[model samples]
Target: MTFVHAGHGATMLFMLLLLLGAGAVGAAVLSRRVIGLRILDYPTGRSAHARPVPKGGGLAILVVFVTGVPLAQMIWHHTPTLADKTLLAATAWLGLFSWRDDMHPMPALWKLGAQVLAALLVAWGSLGILPHDGTAWGMLLGRSLWLVVLCNVLNFMDGLDGLAAGCTLLACVVTAILCLHAGAGVDTWGTALVMAVAIAGFLPFNFPNARLFMGDVGSQCCGLVLGALGLHMANLPPLAHGWALMPLMLSGLLADVGVTLLRRTMLRRPLLQAHREHIYQMAHRGGMQPATITVLAWAATLCGAGAACALAGGVIGLPAAAGGVLALQLAWAVVVIRRVRHTPGLRW
Candidate 1:
């Protein structure tokens, strides 16, 4: 028992150090060239910051995360897990493709193809599109679809500085605590620790008026990592608690993106066009500062994720917990939308 505890502790420490080091290196590279490149300039948009800032700093976070996973596998003397390796390969490719798009805007079809391929890679390799233990193909398909949708939702939510990172950090921390209580293995804990550290190191540079934006590299990379982790947690044996908790953990983001897309579609608006229609953006437009909006969103995420962890631990029933959280998030969204609509100077 003591040996197990020590090993877990060491793994967590190692992951944190690896992520921090990698993030620092990525940030340094971006800080030097990010402002000067202006390769694929960020044009003014509705939700855009007052001034154009260097984007693609997320490549730094991606660099640190993708490289650190394999390095940690070797250091721990454990064979690289199949899920981890598959996710890394897919995410690396996705990051590269996104970075390419960021450098030179690609056609919509090409971007969609890349996202599909990346999603398929994870579905085939990690989640195994065919269900096991009598689970139906429909169930497997639903899960895979959820993975892809969630990945895109997170990517869409990356409009504001530090928003995605802050939300992801909160989700990871909650997941880590649940996994720890459930006696999850070192790999699970290590993955969470690394993500926490990476986001923590990157947040300072990203918050408020960011010096650098995460861009495509960071957003897609993070989506992949979180998606992969969500699958891993859900696949854990016996209880498979992650499935029950996922909706709550992701309630805020899922609600925001889903509602925005649905609302846009209903109004015959182009879904793919960049816009400042998210609830967070609306909150900002409604006399709230960016930082205040971010904090409110983060606080809501923490509550939802905490409720998810508690439900997963069997302290609370899943349905009631998930439904309650969802209701709260939906209410928040409706209020934000109403405020945005009524506010005289608000732009959506």
Candidate 2:
């Protein structure tokens, strides 16, 4: 739906600036603090980083992007709708519980349940993915499950430095640009940009022999927000909506994780077990530099997000944009899996 509450272009720009600056500073400061406190993550069998590194640095993002962005909206008197209010509460709860988990290990089921509850609140109480006219129970159920599953998968895919943060940044920025270009309302543009800038703050400390890891805190927080925002954009009122185009934003991630799981399952491997057989991980094991693999995955994300945008904006003549993106991701996954130049020395 077209929102017309007077001029918001300038306000939006100002908020973007605030989020970006705050996120970067918060991340840098929090990284130092975390390191000093010895809140570190040691390498494990299912791990990515080689050395111990500070974790829970995502609190900087929660403060600057998740909590701070909404606070700024309130200060600017944006008059948040119930949907916005729900988003605020949900983001906070997800970040809060995840932060708790970062400091002290929590039951896996508890985290999964929190994720499901967060998704349900947004999907049922706030941003209904289906319309109000008919029986949307099925759609809501599917959407709820989708949000929770995607949130976990995205969290799972956060296997390497800068991988999750960078993919999220790409998805948010591309979606925001597309929404703006399509003359979409401030809702999409504002939320997407806020997420992008916040992730930017955390990204620097991640990747390349990092200062810290986003840990489960950053991963889950970013995943939940990104999933919600994608749903928001996809469910935008009757007009100018593209529910089908939404998943393409994370096509690369979904494809890799999905394919990897299917392969393991076919081999009779326990599905619940943690392993490093993801295409990106395989690429890393195949002597590809972590940076190179991350860059390639990010490039795939860019292409997929761009295609999704094109589909959403009516630039594409067909409804096959999501398929196109998925095909690319699948092909990339295959290449990475097949091109292992050497067997992994580490117990994967």
Candidate 2 achieves a global lDDT of 0.74
Clashing pairs in 1: 58-214, 58-218
- The lDDT values for all models are 0.73, 0.74
lDDT of 2 by residue, 281-309 (tens): 88887777888888887998888777876
**Candidate 2 segments exceeding 4 Å error:** 1-16, 128-134, 237-241, 317-319, 341-348
lDDT by residue (tens digit), candidate 1, 1-348: 999989987986676566557655665565446556764445575755877677776666666667766666555566766666667788889888998888887887787778778877776667544566555555555656766686687788887777888888888777777777777764665667666666666777788768777777777777777776777678765334677565577788888888889989999999888788878878877866778777777887888887876677677887777778888887887788788888897767
Residue-pair clashes per prediction, in order, are 2, 0
lDDT of 1 at 281: 76
Where does candidate 2 have its weakest 10-residue lDDT segment?
A: 1-10
Provide the clash count, candidate 2: 0
